[model samples]
Target: MLLITCPECGARPETEFVCGGETHITRPGPFAEVPADVWAGYLFHQANPRGKLRERWRHQAGCGLWFNLVRDTVTHEITSVYRMGDPKPEIA
Candidate 1:
């Protein structure tokens, strides 16, 4: 089982967290004319990295706050966790 480190409530089981998808997507602004491809890319395209990945996750059963998680997909290891507004520190 994977252990997710909650930014507010310390380390907990992965079941307590909810995957919130990629972290760097920008919504189209009003009066902005974005191409269909651009919209599709934002909605569908994602990076399936093997090593450390930066993603958005919500602590559904704990603090109920959305936070950023830097985790390893291959080994199911969490490198670091932090809130959205806070700066991410370098993972040791």
Candidate 2:
């Protein structure tokens, strides 16, 4: 099982967290100004890469806080984890 480290709590098993999906996804500028296609793209588009990727995970069983982590989609090797609003890490 994946051992994810929560910012509020300590390390926990993957079962305690929910994989929210890929990170770095921004909401289209403003709700009212966004076009239908653009808004739909923003809501439905997601990257399904095989290598290193950044994703969001929530500690559902622990602190209930959301955070981001850089992990490999192929091997599931996590490189780093950070808070929600923090600057994106340089994934190498």
Residue-level lDDT of model 1, residues 1-92, one tens digit each, is: 88888877988988998999867567764526888888777778888877878889999988898999888888877777778977766644
lDDT (0 to 1) per candidate: 0.81, 0.91
Give the range of the ten consecutive residues with the poorest summed lDDT in model 1.
23-32
Top TM-score prediction, candidate number: 2
Report the C-alpha lDDT of model 2 over 1-92, residue by residue, as the tens digit. Answer: 98999989978999999999999988888788998999888778788888999999999998899999999999998889999999999976
Please estimate how well model 2 matches the true structure, expressed as its whole-model Cα lDDT: 0.91
For model 1, what is the error of residue 6's alpha carbon versus the real structure, in angstroms, after optimal superposition? 0.9
Model 1 reaches what TM-score against the true structure? 0.84
